[model samples]
Target: MEQNKEMTAQESLQLISESFNKSRKDILRGSAKYFMLWGALLTVTSLAIYLLWHFTGKPQWNFLWFAMPAIGYPLAALMGKYDEALPQNEVSKMLTGVWRVFGAFAITLSAIAVFLVPMHVTLIIVIIMGLAECMSGVLLKNWPIIIGGFLLGVGGAVFAMLVKNDAQLLIFTLGGVLLLITGLVMKLQYK
Candidate 1:
């Protein structure tokens, strides 16, 4: 009877381990695609903002930043609809929570920066985004993502501070590149 209990416990542990592994794979696969999508969108939007603002000498071009989510969210939703359904798992829930918080915080800060407070909004957002990426990488145990996030979060922050005027938009371009690279790496590894 005691041996039976031990076997049952061991079997349960094995089942849990298998579930974690399976869910991690599914989540990482989906997330890799999202990283690529957002990365490309960010890169293109940042460049467009930089050009329009630089040539026109109008800060209002910054408003284009909002277009990112306008496009990204719908595409992401569509992609989610197609992805194989993932099982409920701790890692997935944690990752979802992290991104949700980030989205809310970013939206709030962007609104305040645009409407009420004129601050170094670009750098602040980049830093926060980097930290979030790094956190995601840590959760996924992906080295490229971790490194990319560190570079974007810390190095990008420093670079943004040093660069002057409209040049700051280039930081987003760099961030997008990093994210793109990370996504490619993940895709290759996971595939």
Candidate 2:
């Protein structure tokens, strides 16, 4: 028991130390894709909001953000098709756990809102953001993706109360801001 505890402590200390004292290659390689992703995400999402808001005027169907995957992701996949991804199965498994719990809870909340809220906004955004969360969960192995799922569910419920078009627009705009803010926070923390 003493040996096990000692080794565990040593492992924990090593992890903490390595995080702060990473190599230049480690730091750059670590943040390169992550920062680029955030840069692309925010840029594309902002553009999508602009285009969707301008063309459709149907902010409810904010489906154009998927275009990022169509353009940006495909390009990256093409670029990295030859390279190998890092071997981090354990972290990925842990991340999947977080995403699963959050996903289930968020979906449950959205389901409840659908039955009780008497509005569709909550349901719609939940579906959209829910898909995003799932993709992040499955692809990126980032646990923070769960927050987006939670926001989508909760934001939808809050949006239900807004009855007028102007008010609805405000609510949706705020929802977009909320997503952007959450993404920025994750970028700052994780980067």
Candidate 3:
């Protein structure tokens, strides 16, 4: 009887450990929603900007990029509400904090870009996004995210070096495509 009790206790402990690990995985997987949303938004906006500038040659079209922050903030707030309702673990809390800081930095950089060097806005934004993505991946232990971040960084560098003047639209379009593909792959893999 004592041996049976011991075995049962061991089994119970094992089950509890497995359950905790699974919960963590679930929280990590939930991140895919944000990735997909941003991916789609970037892809569509980049393409639209590219087409508009390429055909019409209007600099004002660049202002459309602001739509990202406008849309992203509300969506992030909703997601944060949902997250607040859930019982988050330490890892989840840390991940949230990391992203919050990233958002703040992005906003600050954007404001500076608007006031100072508006022409390099796309490259600056992409590089910042790449760093954020890489940091998130490191924190979450997600390889796809890390790879995606590197791609964004490389794309930004290429854009900065190769494209000058209004032709930078190509870089934005390419970055958008890379983001979209990365998000889709992450969603499918994590789901």
Candidate 4:
């Protein structure tokens, strides 16, 4: 009877662990898509901004960043539709809250950057993104995201200090590449 009780307990623990893992993976996979989308958008925009400024000497072209919202909003909404359609358990609900807070913080930081130091906005944004990624990684117990986030934060700071003028292009490009790589790693490893 004691042995049967022990076996049952072990089985319950195993099942709990498996459920937790599945929930975590589902959340991470959803997040990976966002990371990849943003990564590609940033990469392309950075290259375009660099080329436009380098060739045409038009500083106003920086306004191209405004397009991000136009593109990102729809994509995010579409993604959210799928997520909302799925039934969320308590763990998933908590994970969703975590990401919601992260998004709010990022948007607030961007708003602040727009007013304070517009010139350094790209680097600042990259650093913020890195921190958010690090937080997500820690929460999910995903090493690739943590490492990528650390690299992006450090790289953005270094680029800011060294590049001086027209640094956004480089910083954004590096951030994009890091995010893309991390997303891809998470997708492959988790799935």
Candidate 5:
């Protein structure tokens, strides 16, 4: 007990420095899987959008898909993983809020698709999903979110290709509306 009390300030500082350095390294090492996961999601979305749009006979915005997921899964999964590696108490909680919002949006989108109830409103929802994905990427400092956004944009355009000119207008309109809603909702919960 006496020896513990006699510990020097310099020694404590050194210990802290060492611990901080170790944590920093740990964060970097653990981030890879998350980044890759994000990247893969972006890449898949990009490809899906490209196919859908191209199949619909619209070649105008399809080119964006090629650049969609340059990062891929491993890089994407590592995104917040880096933060997790740090001595993050506050930041982690905040980031998880974003993740939670994202998860909600995901569920909503999945429900929409699974129900097979396509509507003008549904198109709007899809757009919202796209924007949510993009925002998530930005918040997390993940490139995959940007890629996801681009893919969503492409996907929206692709939807236009599937229908006639008159119907295209409706789909595009709702898609934009829903995207706006999605973005807003996601932004509200943004940490």
Candidate 6:
């Protein structure tokens, strides 16, 4: 039989703190792969869309942007499955919640841009992506991610504004490169 010992408040708080720290480290370790994965997909898709739109002279090729999520979600799901052994914690839950909300916002805004509005959807999406990444960095206490998000969000937006027509798609490529570097930094640092 095990004896039950009551923990003091200080000891309980310490245990909670330890758990949170451990959860954070685990989440950060796994997040690098996701950054790289999405970054690669975004880069490739942007290039493809750019080439198709350029050579074919069809602006409708812009719809190919949707392929990023189509490919990324399944791969991410597989990665998440592999990581299922790790216990769920508050940090993980919050990060997932943040991304889910961002995804919804992106999809909704893209749809609205395609169907109703004549706004700069690429600029808006890049900003949202950067905000989401920066929020994740804030939660994970990662500087590289924070800096990357700021560059992709602000710099990319400015670049998008300056470039014309098909050139705007290249902004996604720049954002993708930033994300890829951020992920590499995280992988090396965490390892």
User: Considering every candidate listed, which one attains the maximal TM-score?
Assistant: 1
**Model 6, position 100: C-alpha lDDT score:** 84
TM-score of every candidate relative to the true structure = 0.83, 0.40, 0.77, 0.75, 0.41, 0.80
Clashing pairs in 2: 122-156
Q: Summarize candidate 5's per-residue lDDT along 1-191 as a digit string, tens digits.
A: 24456558997898779877566444433433343344345445545554566568664443443243344434544554565534544334454465457556645554564467544433554466566557655754657446756576568657855764334434433333433433343333332
Tens-digit lDDT track of model 3 for 99-189 = 5776677667767777775556666766777776677667667787788778777767777778765677666566556656655665565
By lDDT, is 1 or 6 better?
A: 1
Q: Write the number of the candidate with greater TM-score, choosing between 1 and 2.
A: 1
lDDT string, candidate 1, 24-46, tens digits? 77666666777788889989999
Best by lDDT: 1
How many residue pairs clash (N, CA or C atoms closer than 3 angstroms) in each of the candidate models, in the order given?
0, 1, 0, 0, 22, 0
All-Cα superposition RMSD per candidate? 4.5, 9.2, 4.0, 4.8, 10.6, 3.8
lDDT of 4 by residue, 1-191 (tens): 24455557788899789988887677666667767877788788878888888788886776676676668779878888876454555544654566567556656666676667455665667677778667756765778778877877877777776775555577778777876876787688779
lDDT (10s digit) by residue, model 6, range 1-191? 22476889998899889877767676666777877987798889988998898899899998887877888999999988877576656756777788788889988898899999878888898899889878878876788788878887898788878887788888888778877876787677666
The C-alpha stretches of model 5 lying farther than 4 A from their native spots are 1-7, 56-90, 113-191
Candidate 4 residue pairs in clash (backbone atoms < 3 Å): none
Worst 10 residues of 1 by lDDT: 1-10
Q: Rank the candidates by lDDT, best first.
A: 1, 6, 4, 3, 2, 5
Question: What is the TM-score (0 to 1) of candidate 6?
Answer: 0.80
The global C-alpha lDDT for each of the candidates, from Candidate 1 onward, is 0.82, 0.50, 0.69, 0.71, 0.49, 0.81
The residue-level lDDT of candidate 3 at 27 comes to 67
Model 2, 1-191: lDDT tens per residue? 24455557788899668755454223323323532553455455555565566676665444444454466556656655655554334433444454446445544554565457644544464455555554554444546656655565566545656453323434444444544554465445445
Candidate 4 differs from the real structure by a C-alpha RMSD in angstroms, to one decimal, of 4.8
Clashing pairs in 1: none
Q: Which window of ten consecutive residues has the lowest lDDT sum in model 3?
A: 1-10
